[model samples]
Every structure is written in structure tokens, then in C-alpha cells.
Target: MQAEAQLAKSAILEVALQLAEKSSWDRIHLFDVAREMGVGLADIHRHFRNKDALAEAWFDLADAALLRLAQTPGWQQVPQKQRLQFAYSAWLDALAGHRRLTREMIGYRLQPEHVHLQVRGVLRISDTVQWIREVAMLPAAGWRREGAETVLTTIFLAVFARWLVDESPGTRKTQVLLGRLLVAADLGARLVAGLSLRSPASLRAFN
Candidate 1:
């Protein structure tokens, strides 16, 4: 029974992906997914409440793949910035085969009129950043943690935007952009650390 349920869920998601590849997300309804999978509407509803939920599940699938890659040996020893690079690289690699669909979905969600989707996108980025922080074994809470999340989220969106249109082989352009951003981030961190060292009381007050 459990396996059958899982299969039904997977079929729904697979059908949704196929539909998304051919049509705009806004036009692709749960009914369409159900029909494509030859399942009852209730079956899809049993797995995903709505299109957004299904999309979030797809993101979760990608995140799971990224997390697995992050767990490989030697990943833990890398510097935080390098770890982030790896995470973002893995994420893009996972989506490479579905680049067109990804681009369409991202573009649709980010449209000015889609405020809800924009908010969801921010939340999703926040979640991804938190995951990256955990894999990097960073401190749980503090100004540094909050700052890292904000910075990493911004970097991910910026790099991801470049990645969508990037045509260079191996996504070399996106990689270069990420490398530069990381260097800038490192320098900024060093400057902040230096200032904190010079004014411990101020740092404490800010914290």
C-alpha cells in the first residue's frame, strides 16, 4: 500500500514535469497532471495540495540530490565559500537537463504580478541557505549566521539568474560570476571581522 502510494505521487510529479515542459505553470492544472498520469484527481490531491506544493516537492527532490552530494567525503573539510560553490554547482547540475522548464518556472514565479510566488521563492532560497549552512557546519545562531543566510541567498539568486541565460560550455560564465562573488564576500567578511576585533564592545552591542 505504501509503495503504491509512493508510486502514485511520483507519477503525479512526473506528469506535472512533462506538462510544465510544454506549457506555462499557470496554465498547467492538477487536473491536467491527473489526466496525464491516468490517476483520479484525488490521487494527486493525496500527494500535493496544489501546483505550488507540487513545485515545492520538485524543489525538495533537487535539494535531496544536492544534500547527498554535499555528504560525500572531503566535502566537510572545504572552506565555507567553497562548500557553497559546490552546493550551488550541484544544484545547477541537477537542473541542467530541465533548464528550459526551470527557466520558465523561475521567470513565471518572479514576475512582478506574482507576489505570492516571489515570496515563496524567497522562502525557498532561505531554506536552501539554511541547508548549506548546516552542511558547512556553521554556528547555529548569531549575526554571522543571519548574515551568511542573507548573503548566500542573494548570491544564489544572482548566480542563478546568470545561469538561466548562460550559454558557455560547462556553465563557465556562471561559475566565474560565483567565484567573484565569493571573493568579494570573503573580503567583506574579513573587513567586518577586523572592525569587530577593533571594537569588541560595538560588536557585542550589535549582536
Candidate 2:
């Protein structure tokens, strides 16, 4: 009995996520998820007490997906330019996949418990700066060290928003432009701070 109940609840949550992705979170009724899962409505209620619970689950799911994608192998083995490009492309795919859910999720920011936005945003910015550092083969200097993360975050969000509204082909041009903009910003920050690029010592530390 316990195993069957657990399976039924998992099915409801899975179906709820799918429905939220296809339409909006608001459109994901218990009846809809239950029907899609071939389960009774009570099965969904058994897992999520109400629609809000299901919506919260959907938000969590989206956050997990973004973090996972940002940590993929393809993202790790590249120049900063390529890494940012890959990240942007991955982000676009996620947005396209969850456009409907995101629209409804956006309206829920009035709620105080919605900390996922800030948490995920900060983590992503850190990841972006790490990518830039690895590719540039250098550590940040002066105020750039403090501000590079914020600059990358701002650049990414601006590029992504433009991507969401752009009807351009493949987002290729936008990606290229954004890449140049980010590289320029990083270089400018370093120059203004009078920082010179230092070679990695592990390559030849003990001569």
C-alpha cells in the first residue's frame, strides 16, 4: 500500500510539471494532472494539498534544471566566449521549454517565500564569472574582482531578455554580440583597475 501510494504521488507531481510547462501554472488543475496521469484526483491531493503546493514544486523543478544545465560538461571545457555562448543557448532552450510556466511564476514574486529567484540568480552569476576566469586564465584584480560577477549577471539577463523577444534566426547574431559585449566589459574592467593577466603557476611552478 505504501509503495503504490508513493508511485501515485510521484506520477501526480510529474504530470503537474508537464502541464505547467505546456500551459501556465495557473492552468494546472489537480483534475488536469490526474487525468494526464490516469490517476484519481485524490491522488494529486495526496501529494500536493493544493494548487499552490504544485506550483511551488514546479518552481523548484525549474531552478534545479537550470543549475544542472549550467554545470554540464560542455560548459566546463571551453573558452570564456564559448562558455558564455553555450550558457546562453542552454538558457534559451530552458525558456522555450518552460515559457508558459515562467509567465505564471513571474506573477508570484509578491510572495515573500519566493527566494529561489535571488538564490538561483546569484549562483548563476558566480558560475558565469568562474567560466570567464577559467577561459581568461586569470584572477580578477581590484574592484573588478568585486564587480565582475555583477557585470556578468547583468549582461546575461539583458542578453536573455532580448533573446526571449527576438525573432532572429538561431539567436546566433545576438549571441555573438552579447559575447563581444561581455568580453569587452571584462577587459575594460581589468584595464581600468590596472590589472595585468598573470600566467597559471601550476604549469611551471618548480623550476
Candidate 3:
């Protein structure tokens, strides 16, 4: 009895995702989810306010996955770039099974008429990037912290854009792109900090 009661939001999310896989987010109704779960509509409401909340709940799964990485063995000992890649890959892999459905959910909410949802999307990106930073243990401060967040957000979006259509084994193609982007961002940041790319003798030859 306790186990069944615990299903609540998580169970509702699973059923909705399964239904969505066969059909779509638009076609699935609260009553359908209740019927599928053999519970009443009120039971579903006890967990989720509406169908859209289920999509948010789905993303929460990825967030939870990313957080778990912090507790992984040697997580804190790893270099920043490697930790970033592992953390980001874990977040994406959580949605790998439902990539198409996840994309559809975003599209449904991104309609021009749904300005509120679009705004929420921006917040979601910010929150995810912040979470990734925390998990990777980046210790940047003030302007440096802000700059790091901006670069991380840009890298995340670029990697995510590639990941959406990536069909490579274990998403190796996306990982390759992610590694290249991180290196490029590092080099760009170094150059901006006035670090010379050429050796001192090379500069002397140009002089």
C-alpha cells in the first residue's frame, strides 16, 4: 500500500511518457492518464497541476541524474573539462531514450502564442547551466563566474543542438563536438586574457 501510494507524481510521469511515446503530448488527457494508472483524476491532481507539469517533471529526471554525478567516485578529483563532459553527457543520456518526445514537448511549448513558456525556457537554460557549474565544482568568482556561466551556457546550447539529431553510437559524435567546443572556448578565453599563443622567439622574429 505504501509503495503504491508513493507512485504519485513519478508514476503519473511515467504513464504520461509512455502514452506520449505512442501518440503525443497534445492528445493525452488527464483522464486518460488516470485511467491508465487505475486511479482517479484527483489522484493525478494530487501530484501534477496539469499535463504540462509532466514535461517539467520529465526534465527533473535529468537534473537529478546530473546531481548524482557529484557523488560519483573521483568526481571532485577530476579536471574541470573532463568533469564537465561527464556531467553534461549524463544529463543528456537521461533523456536519450525519449529524445524525440522531449523535442516535441519543447516545440509544443515554444509556439509564439506561449510567450510565458518561452520565457520559462530561458530560465530553464540558466538553471541547468548553473547546476552544471555547481556539479563540476568551478570556483570562478564575480566577473569570472559570470563569464564562465556565459561560456558554459553557449557550449551547452551548441552541444545540445548537435545532440538532438545525433544518432552515433553512445552519442560519440556529440561528445566529439563537445570536446572541440570546450577546447575552443578555453583558447578564446586565454587569448582574451592576453595570453600569447606564439613563443617569445616567434614574436622576436616578427619584430
Candidate 4:
């Protein structure tokens, strides 16, 4: 039963995507998806609350891709800075095939009327950031973890916004931006660590 339900959801999601490619995501209705699957509206409802939920499911795929790529052999051996780079790179790659459609999905969620979805979107981003930290093995805690989350959230949104419209060959532009920002973030983290490590015996004793 569990496998059947999971298969149903995957089928609905895939059918929705196929329809979206033929038409705009906003233009595709639940009826369209149901009809494509030869299932009732209740069937889709069982799998997704609505179209926005389906969009969330799509982003979930990207998160899975990022985690898989991040935890691959030797990922631990890679420099921490590059680990972050790899995370975002893998995520965007999952959406690269449907860049325009993905952009539309995000825009739909951000519409002024969808205040609840907008709020959920923010939480969704934070969840993804947490995954990035876990996969990259970032050791930040307390205030440092909070600060790191803030910095990474900003970088991800900015880079993702660029990717929504980027046409550069192989998304090199987005990758370049991600690398530069990650390196800068790493440098800032190192600087903070150095400053916080003041010797207890020194006059400026701070742990």
C-alpha cells in the first residue's frame, strides 16, 4: 500500500510536469493532471493538497539530488568551501532542464494573495539550507549557526534568482557566482574563528 501510494504521487507529479511543459504551470489545472492520469480529482488530492504542494514536491526532488551528490564518496575529502559549491550545483542541475517552468512555479507561490504559501516558501528555503549544512558538515553552532544560515540563505536566493533567467552556456555564470560567494563566506568564517580564539592568558581573553 505504501509503495502504491508513493507510485501514485510520482505519477501525478510527472503527469503534471508534462502538462506544464505543454502549457504554463498556472494554466494547468488539477483537472488536467487528473485527466492525464485517468484518475479522479480525489486521487490527486490524496497525493497533493494542490498545485503549490506539487511544486514543493518538485523542489523536494532537487533537495534529494543535492544530498545524493553531497554525500558521494570523497565529498568529505573535498574542501568545505567546494562542498557547499557542490551542494548548490547539484540542486540547480536538477532544475536546469525546466529552468523557465521552475521560475514560473516560484513566481506563482510568491503572488501577493498566497501569503500562507509565501511563508511556507521561506521555511522551505531554511530547510534546504539546513540540509546543505548537514551535507557539507558545517560545524557552526549557536550564534555562529544562525549567522551562517543567514549568509547562506542570502547567497542561495541571489544565486537562484540569477539562475532563473541565466542563459550562459552550462550555467557557468551561476556556478561562478556560487563559487565566489562560497569562498567569501569561508574567508569570513575563518576570520571570525581567528578573532574568537583570543588566548585566555592574553589581556583580550575570549573563548
Candidate 5:
């Protein structure tokens, strides 16, 4: 029964992606997704409350895949910075086939009228960065933790924006941008560590 439910949800999301590519995410209705999947609107509702929920589910799918990748032996042995670079690369590769739809969805979510979506976007990025921190065995609490999430989220957004227009073969441009961002992140992490060690009271103050 769980498998059947998962299949139904996947079908709805697949149809929604196709619709978003054909039209605009703003114009995509649950009814259209249902019709495309040959299911009742209520069926899609049973899986996702609304378009925003469906969009979030899409991100959740990517998150799940990333977690799986992070668990692989190849990922387990990488340096902290390299682990992040690998994860980000894998994430963008996952969405490569859906680039156009993803780009359009980002634009739609960024509009002033979609303030809620913008908030959700930040939350989603925070969640993903938190997961990366865990997998990389980084600090899990305090100001440093929060600061790392902020930096990683900023890097992700910058890379994502560039990726939308990046035309270099094999996404070399995106990879270069990610590499540079990770380098900066490493420096930031080192600086934060130094501060934390030198002034434990300052760390507590921020926390």
C-alpha cells in the first residue's frame, strides 16, 4: 500500500514538472496535474495539499537522493570541503534534466507576490545545509553551526543562479563556481574555529 501511494505521488509530481515546463509554474493548477496523470484532483490533493506542497515535495525528493549519495563509501572518505562540493555537484546533476522547469520555478518563487515561497526556499536550503553539516560531521550547534549554514546556503543559491544560465559543456562553469565557494567556506570555517577557540566567551555570547 505504501508503494502504491509513493507511485501515485511520483506520477503527480512528474506530470506537474511536465506542465511547468510547457507553461509556467504560476499557471499550473492541481487540476491540470490530475488530468495529465489521469487521476482525480482529490488524488493529487491526497498526496500534496497544494502547488507549494508539491514543489516542496520535489525538493524533498532531491534531498533524499543527496542523503543516499552522502552515505556511499566514496563520499564517506572525502575531506569536509570536498564532501560538500561532491554533494552540491550531485544535487545539480540530479536537476540537470529539469533545468528549465527548475529555473522557471525559481523565478516564480522569487516574485514579490510569492513571499511565502521565498521564505520556504530559504527554509529548504537551510534544511539541506543542516543535513550536509551532519553528514560531514561538522559542529552541530552554536553560532558556528548557524554561520556555516548561512554560508553554505549562500553558496548554493549563487551556484544555482549561475547554473541556470551556465552553458559550458559538462557544467564546468558551475563546477568552478562551486569550487571557489567551497574554498571560501573552508576559510570561513577556519576563521570561525579560531575565534571560537580564542574566545570561548564570545561564542557563548552569540549562542
Candidate 6:
């Protein structure tokens, strides 16, 4: 009985994944997933309460895979810039591998307060950002902190957008551009802050 229950549960999730690949998440329905799974709708409900629950589970899988990648033995040994590149690259690879399904899943915004369902995905992204900062030797306390975080997130989204359509080789150009932009912005902000500290009167001198 337990084995049969587990099989039904797996079928429900599998059908949902297939539906996502074929269409948008908004179009996915529990009834349809059950139909595709060759099981009754009641069987699916026994496993997943609703479409939202399944969406959360799908993202949870993606989040777990990302955390695993981060824990690989050689991952930390890479340079900070390379680390950022790898993080983006892995996301691109995952999206590419599950392009149809991910396209739908990525569109849903999990509520910030929904800690129970969103915790793993939220922590994965947060930790990755923090890891990048630490490896770059970036100071946590500074005027640049906000700006750096903004830029990093922007670069990440931009890379994903490009990967969605880019046919270029290994996204080499895109990766290089993103890396240069981030490094330049970080260094430039730090330099400006340093100068401001040392030459506060320079502004008046210029005026």
C-alpha cells in the first residue's frame, strides 16, 4: 500500500513537470496532471493539495540541486569572479536542461512571508550572494553594500535573460561582459568611497 501511494505521488509530480514544459505555470491544473498521469484526480490530491504546492515543490528541487553544486569539493577553490560565473552558468544549464518547465516555474513569485515553502530557495540565493561577497573580500559595512547587491542581482537576471535566447558559444562573451561590469562597478564604488573619506573638502574645491 505504501509503495502504491508513493508511485501515485511520483506520477502527480511528473505530470506537473511535463505540463509546465509544454505550457505556462498558470495553465497547469491538478486535474490535468492527474489525467496525464493516468490516475484519478483524487489520487493527485492525496499527494499535492493544489497547484501552488506543486510549484513550491518543483522550485524546492531546483534549489536543492543548486545547493549541492555549491558544496562540491572544488567549487570554493575557484576565484571569486569565477565563482560568480559558475553560479550563473549552473543556473543557465539548469534552465536549459529544463527550459520548458523552468520557464513556467520561474514566473511564479513566492510570497516573502511564506517561509515554510520558500525558505530553501530564498536561502540558496542569499547564501550564494554572501559567498560571492566574501570571496571578493568585499566589506559588508559600507555605502557600496546596497549598490553592490543591486548590481549583482541585476547581472544575474541579465545573464539568465541572455541565456534564454543566446546561441553563442558557451555564453563566453556574456560571461566576460558580466564579470567585467561587476568587478568594475565594485572597484569603482570602493575607490569613490575611499576618496570621499580622504578628500571630503575636494567637493568644495571643485565647486
Q: Each model's C-alpha lDDT? A: 0.75, 0.58, 0.82, 0.82, 0.76, 0.60
Over 4 Å off, model 5: 139-141, 191-207
Ranking of models by lDDT = 4, 3, 5, 1, 6, 2
RMSD of 1: 4.5
- Give the RMSD in angstroms, all C-alphas superposed, for model 6: 8.1
TM-score for each of the candidates: 0.83, 0.57, 0.88, 0.90, 0.85, 0.61
Candidate 1 worst ten-residue window by lDDT: 198-207
Report the C-alpha lDDT of model 4 over 1-207, residue by residue, as the tens digit: 999988888889888888899989889999999987788999899989988889998999999998897658877677666777888888899988778889999989888999999999999999998898788777667788888888889889989999998899998899888888876776676577564433231211111
Ten-residue region with minimum lDDT total, candidate 2: 198-207
Higher-scoring candidate on lDDT, 3 or 5:
3
Indicate the residue-level lDDT of 145 in model 1: 61
List the candidate 6 regions with Cα displacement exceeding 4 Å.
1-11, 22-26, 40-43, 105-144, 169-177, 192-207
Evaluate candidate 5 by giving its C-alpha RMSD to the native, one decimal: 4.5
Q: How accurate is candidate 3 locally (lDDT)?
A: 0.82
**Residue-by-residue lDDT tens digits, candidate 2, 56-170:** 5554443444456555666544555455555455545655555545546555533567686556545654665455444433345555555765666677667755664665676
Total clashes, candidate 4?
Answer: 0
The candidate with the higher lDDT, 1 or 2, is 1
Q: Which pairs of residues collide in candidate 2?
A: none
Name the lDDT value of residue 170 in candidate 4.
92
